[model samples]
Target chain A: MNASTSQDRFCEELTALLPRLRRFARGLARDPADADDLCQQTVERALKSRQSWQDGTRLDAWVYRIMRNQWIDEVRARTRRSQTFTHEEEGANIGAPGDLAAENLVELGNVGRALARLPEEQREAVILVLVEGFAYKEAAEIIGVPQGTLTSRLGRGREALLRELGEIA
Target chain B: MTVSDDEFTAYVDGELTGAEAQRVAAAIAGDPALASRLEAQQRLRALLRGHLDPVAVEPVPESLTQMIAAAAAEDAERDMTDTKQHEPARVLDFAAARARRDDQVRAARPPRLTLPRWWGTGAAIAASLVLGLFFGMRVADDGASVTSGGALVASGMLAKGLDEKLASANEPGKLRILTSFRREDGNYCRVYDAGASSGIACKDAQGWILQRTVANGAPERGAYRQAGSAAGELMAAAQTMAIGEPLDAAQERAARREKWNK
Candidate 1:
């Protein structure tokens, strides 16, 4: 590792973001395999574009931007294929959540389960703002939405998640 | 003051400040329903964070992390004069495909040369360790590989390791398969560590052709790799020759079935 290089520093911080990246991916994709695949793409994209990232800026927002863009691309691709490709948990992923193998790894909490089942837009808002602790403006920027639109999605997502978790409880 | 749900959402998210925040504070204090709604968003935030924070801490797959570090490190290590010709960035750009190798493989310079049986199969230590020197297809009278018109051809144990060993099946033996990948033109290649030395070989035509060799010089292993390790240098060579991600065990097994053609 080039300890003194700025690239090294960038990667170090990027490595630190893995957990939250994984969590955000899981939230957005709603499938463990997809989440990991998303996470891998995000890291790859982030690294490839490491030069474009301005110094003294928040790496989290930059990475989240790359992640959501890749995911949006994936979601768009899946939407197109939804009619023809029966797209069950992709062919090679070991286990999707709720599968016995994944269940054995960690028995997911009820709130986590409810969050996973939320609608895509709402899930994105919830994960960015609530789960990732990003401010509304930052979350909006990451999602490429206006603050007003972001708040609306957050409100709807929050209400649905509350209702869903209430049932799970 | 009846705070709209959007205003309440912003307030809960800590985005509403000063007058609007104060207004929400007063409303929540006076109305149990408002207070409960406020508490619900806060609870959800906590719940969501609680649920997701653990994933960030979970062991990041080594491949993902290493990809970033090694790519950057190699980018720094590469000589400026090497090649200005650039290939498009690919997610599968995991091989050490230097331009020369790509050109050599593309032109199909020579008919496939057969490796001599005298090259010695099985766990033979690479009799020499030429660390830090890229002896381009430098053939030995009695070596694991020989060059035919500058392209390194794998013979002996190196050839056997490239043919049979899989990195996924990491058994401690004399031959250690580090990784396998395909080049841009679609030939399969592998990096290996055998006793004292390691090198990379790409399967061209009908057999494993050694592309480059150094004394255990495989770079770009992972970012955590110590700088200038001979093992890393070998991988660095492999990286320039590859335009695809390393073959996982299944892909490697599949490649083997096809004898690594194309």
Candidate 2:
């Protein structure tokens, strides 16, 4: 395929992936508005830099990596401005109405809240692995960490989350 | 021996191979606590998936698709235009000529004294004299009626230009405006951009001072039509004057509470 044609196909594929991307973004960003904004920014950056993509590779991994970088960039900008939001503050606005099962919704809300409590690295690992269903190697690649480190983060993150949600003794 | 949390996670993720998985299963089967812990991990995974599954199934917004399509179209146009402007042979010839010129200059003898250094010194003195003449003319023009010191002193057309023309907010695509009541270290800061450059200025006992300047891409000219143009420049000049770190969130909030009166 010509470069433009290939880029068009990539856009089509990315369009199909948007809902899942939004879910991953929502998982990371507790506020729905911020989550949508994050997803939009990621998609925009990906589309603008489509030349960087290699053919026959996993498109999902490429998109996720872009999203992760966008999130980190935003975090850095916010830090430069000295802005911070606590987990409680972040969670206060996220529970959507009438769309999800109540128990499941509450669990999701708790998970979102729990996610905010995690250190940045652990949260990223958990999001990529359990939430986004990336394989360990893919998750590690996306986060730019070793596979062993990713697993360790996931292990610690799950334990901490369980404790926070009162799921542990 | 019982399996650890990490081992259970590995097994659940299928990271453990043949014997390792079997050993973990055996341990789980034999140990009630281990079995419960394993179940808890399984439940957590299911819980997480259950909540996230709806999001996965949620329809992609139409607006996002449209935006990406538009961006792709724009990129294609840009690439086509670039290709038309630079034929391969012409580009190679241009590079070759530029390389020859550079080689000639390198081979040329150095002047007895460097022309740039001599010119730079002369230019510096001339610049100071011009500044003095301009200000002197201004004083004479105003009949010495206006004292050229303090906040009011920095309130003329030049000051206005410094405030309005030097900001990034006046730039086209990458306009940014920052306003802080007080920096984290307790100084006021404002940053703005114009065209290809952005600058930060700070306020102190000395007056508004320029701090840092950075040049990015060319800013949009259309931004000048906005009411914010002058304000943008003032903020840019303020950023140039900043001292210490820009205000932290808490300090900025406090400064805002005071209405930036300082």
Candidate 3:
């Protein structure tokens, strides 16, 4: 394919990857707005660095790596401040109408709260392996960690998550 | 022998293989405690997935899809630089000629530098100027719009064009104004035919926030009247966002006189 066509194909494929990428971002950011911002920034960087991405390799992994780095390097600190500025005050305003809706809210709340309690490292490890369904090694490479480190992080994260779920249940 | 927590976690993730996996399997089968731990591990994964996966099903924000469209439009334009539209091998050869013609050719070409039309409010100009001064990447002269305080704000000449130009004026600049109308929420929105892309920006509290920009399949250079698929899409978007027919020359001129105030 020509360069432009190839790039167009890349963008097309990248567009297809958005929904899953947003889910992974939500796992990392724990805030919906910040997660969306993270997704947009990731797509932007992915386009800018399109030449760098290997064609046959996994686009999801490559984009996830960009997002993980973008989060760690830049977005995390900035969004954390804004999340408090807007979302925290705005959070209590979310109204659940009935018992079932309230129950569902608490269930989601339990998951988010549980994920929040873990350190960022452990949180990502758990999200990558368990929630997003990456293998130990693939998740490791995406997060720029060794396989052993990822396994240990996942183990500890798994333990913590289990305890949190048990307490809430 | 007891499997370590890592081994157990890996087992739950099904990451283990061959004899190592067999050993973990054997251990879990023999050890009641290990079996329960494995079940708990499996349960945690299921729980997290149940609550979190729904986010994937939620509708994606239009901003994101638009950002992708904008990026695609950007690539289409950068790839455009010329009119003949060659095949792959020739496109590269053409790249060499393009490189000879202008220093900024190919992907290395910088973000937008000229204004076909608009300038920001003085404060908007000052904010982006200071922003450009420090950030370096968010340059002013090249781009018609730049992000300010996390929001998209029309910058430089484009902002000036948006504030003053009327569609009914009938003269075309490098960037042609497609239409100007009030949106459903009463914001004054203007569409511009920007070569490879068609963009619409609405005047807002932060200046003109580029509401939508979609890439036309190819840049016709000066063919403003011809509606390509991208133009069709951009017009459809404008149609959806607009409250009524686009303003006439008199209306546009008057809106300009009032400084586009709602």
Candidate 4:
């Protein structure tokens, strides 16, 4: 395909990946608005640098990596400005009322708060492997870590989440 | 021998293969503690997935889609520039060349009001009333209709344009209809943008009541940013008002034909 056609096709495919990317971002960022912003930044960056993306590799992985790096950059920038990344009030307001019962909603809220409490590294690993369904190797590649590191993070993350959800003592 | 936490995690994740996975399974079968731990891990994973997977299927926000479209348009423009650099030029008559240049300039410029015939009486009265009530005598030239009290208010052509036009018509400089949806109260609301400003208006007896308008700095004439900070209020308004998924093109067409009746 010609350059423009290829880019158009790439964007079309990228659009299909948006929800998954946004979910991953939600795991990484503390608030829904921030996560959406991160997702938008990743998409914009990915489109601007489409020439650099290889044609055959997993586009989802590539986009995930972009989101990961974007989040890191945002955190660094926020740190330099001495601003807090997690907005407790904003994060609290982020949850929309769903079709679930009040008890299930509370449970979901607990799970969300628990997920948000995990260390950033552990959260990243859990989201990639457990949520996004990435293999250890694929998740590691997206997070720029070794397979062993990813596995360890997932293990620790699982334990923490289990404890928080009262699934374990 | 006990299976390590990493091994258990790997097995649960379906990453273990052959003898490794078999060995873990056998260990779990033999050791009750290991079995319980494995069960806990599995449960936790499942529970997290259950709680979070909904986000993945949540309706993709319109602002994000607009952002992606804007980026793609920028990419296309860059591609056009690159192609122009490599292509051969064609000679044309002076008038034709000038006309082509004018068209290009016009395309680059933001949408301007063409003053449709109905504007003379209808829009003129609405515009004067809204402007006088909101901005008093001296209106701001920021392309945003706002009140003297520093609130965004839609009036005149902007309000009328959003009411009468279908997004499919694709008029330049006109209010671009971003999306439409019915509110919980059964009123129809639309997200719209002019050259620079964007807001949400819900139809009522008063005619396209301006629910909320945002006056961020004007984006470049033809270049709209979907996720601009200016849209934050409008987005929040849309999120709060939208009862369900915004209507698709066909639904939007039908709604327009019905003159946005409930």
Candidate 5:
């Protein structure tokens, strides 16, 4: 069919996937506002270039991939523009031992902080395999890595998270 | 028998086949250390899933559905606009309409594309058409019309300015057009364009609203060759434009509620 018609169809499909896409963005972004902004950006990009979308292909993966790329770009931009600062130095400290027992909320907060600290590759593997429930192969394809690579990243990510959360043996 | 990390991970993922899987299971059953490791892995997996799975399987949001429908309508308008500008004599094709609908669904979920490999070829053809239209329209006098020389000249500085300027305030060598309109929610949404780059910017009561930037040469190349390969990138950008469902007459009225500050 003609280009315009195809693009029209693409917009329809992309609109349908927004909620899931927003959720994925939220997971990656952590902050609701950032996630929503990212989701909006993802949708905007997908709609504008709907013609680039392959017919009969999964729009979720395509959108996720775009979100992933956008997230990475943001992180890179943040890193480039900002000065290096530790969590504590940045006013993100979770506090010490005496404060720990009373801090279930803080502990959960720590989980998010630790998750954020994991390497981007590892975090992606964890998000895809553990959160998204994608099969190993599917996760690998989405991340553009080998299945073995994804498995390894997931393993390392989990191990690191466990250590950070004080759950590791 | 003892299971290594790989064995345990595989077992947890249910990847081991036949005797090997059985072997891992038996090891986990009999060996405390192995079983403990398995438990730990399982717990970690569970926690991760607990946090993330909900996001994947969550009920699709209504806003998203509205956005998708509105996007579809917007694409139809864009198509109509293009057709009017480029091929006014031709009648709209019904098969093309159905195909466009199907294409929308397909483009919405790109991961599903791999399962049916045969559909890929058709997707590629459709993708080429989409990109061709986008680029063709970029060059053509309709739908965000851009003169070739004007676009090329605008590319160098505008692209950089949009990339750098986050706020609506004017910066050196930056062209910002701002318009305020009430959104469906009665909140204002703004739109802007960075003149140097072929990027559109919108803003509302909130600061810089939305910025959609496209590098000029890429569209030019795709337009001339009608290359299907470039369709993926083109489709991605198109989706970005799908942000606020195309401004409806009512929404446009709402949008006019606030004056845009460029």
Candidate 6:
């Protein structure tokens, strides 16, 4: 097939996966706008390195890897600028609590805030496994951790999340 | 026998297999404490999903779909360019080299000019032809466009501005054309940044149709992208609207002379 045909097919496949991509993005960035921006950047990066994406590998995992990297870079840049020194400060940057309250969606708003308060790695692990429902192996590969490491991070992340929600000991 | 945290975590994830999984399941059923721990893990997973999963189903913003489409267009252009550069070499070495070798063995016989297999497939020729058409629509330049009342209609100066303005040299005027191109529908489209607002316009039978406009606000010298100040955003919309690349100066001039092919 010609390049155009190949690219069109590739894009069609990728576009079908956008909703899941947005969900993962929302998990990473509490703010809706930021999540969309992150999704945009991920698509751009994946398209640029189209050849580097091996066929037969899961495209969702590849795109997730790109998004995770992009989010990490953004966080580091924000930190260097001292824009958000703590995770709570990061949640503040999202500025959704007031809006959530206005809409009477306080439970969701609190859950989102609590998720954001987890350390970055823990949050990533938890989001991939819990929110996105990637299998353990696939989640490990996307997060670039060994199976054991992924499970450990997930354990810590879930523990923290439950504690923050005041659900259990 | 008590399970370690790793085992418990793995069990929660369903990683344990065969007898081990069975063992964990039986243990949980027998021990209230173990069952409660398992329940907490499952609840936490469900709660997280309950909170954020709504974003998955919510209508994806138009900007995101546009962005993804724009990126795909770009990747196609890059791939076409790469193929154009390398395809000929492979053809010459494989087909031409074999033909030359055959001619040498036949002494004084004329060499058969055999085109590459892909040449017969018509992909290379089709690829080149499509490149110009694709890149014309794919490459991003500058400006943005939005509809005023959900439709892209324009008249008076906006149409006149597109017909006369040269993107290369900005005129100190209200409406400046950042770039122009032909849409796939054979209509002409222009992206314009008009001081406080930027938008895209396409020429139809009626005249320039305003596709989209962003209220960029007062052009601040230094600040976060004020509303839709990013001309690239407008250009992206133009690309989606366009059939091919923004016309070069020569093409633009010819287009103007023809009054945008109207």
TM-score of each model, paired residue for residue: 0.52, 0.50, 0.53, 0.51, 0.49, 0.54
- DockQ of every model listed? 0.35, 0.31, 0.41, 0.36, 0.24, 0.37
Q: B54-79 in candidate 5: lDDT tens per residue?
A: 66566665655666678777666556
Q: Write the per-residue lDDT of candidate 6 for residues B45-71, one digit (tens) a residue.
A: 787888888888898778767866987
What local lDDT does model 1 show for residue B227?
Answer: 19
Worst 10 residues of 6 chain B by lDDT: B113-122
Candidate 1's residue-wise lDDT over B1-262, tens digit each? 7988767767887888899999989989999998877776677777777777777777878888788778766555442111212324421331343343344333432233211111110100111212212222222222233222467677887787778887767565667676777888888877776644556778888577767655432232321122124444555556677674456455678899887888
Q: Which portions of model 3 miss their true places by more than 4 Å?
A: A74-108, A167-169, B1-4, B80-262
| Candidate 6 per-residue lDDT over residues A5-111, each given as its tens digit | 66676778788888999999888876777888898898878877877876667889999999999988887776555534457667556542212233433444667
| TM-score of model 2's chain A | 0.80
> Per-residue alpha-carbon lDDT of model 3 for B192-235, expressed as tens digits?
65544557889987888887775443323332222233344455
The digit string of per-residue lDDT tens for model 3 on A1-169 reads 4668777888888888888999998888766767787888898898889988777788889999999898786545554554576666563443211112344335547777677767778888999888888888899999998999998888787778887798543
Off by over 4 Å in 2: A1-5, A83-108, B1-5, B17-19, B71-262
Which scores higher on DockQ, 1 or 2?
1
Q: Mind giving the per-residue lDDT tens digits that candidate 1 earns over A80-150?
A: 55535544555224222222234623555677667655666777888887778899889999999998888
Model 4 agreement with the true structure over B1-262: per-residue lDDT tens digits: 7888768877988999999999999999999988887777777778777767788999998877787787677668666445434444422443454465445434532344121111111122222322222222222256554422333345798777766766445455545665577899988888675644567787766667767766534334322322233343454466577764455445567777777778
Instruction: Give the runs in model 4 whose Cα sits over 4 Å from its true position.
Output: A1-5, A83-108, B70-262
- Specify the CAPRI tier of model 3: acceptable
How close is chain B to the truth by TM-score, in each candidate? 0.40, 0.30, 0.40, 0.39, 0.28, 0.42
Superposing all C-alpha atoms, what RMSD in Å does each candidate have to the true structure? 14.8, 18.3, 18.7, 20.0, 20.2, 19.1
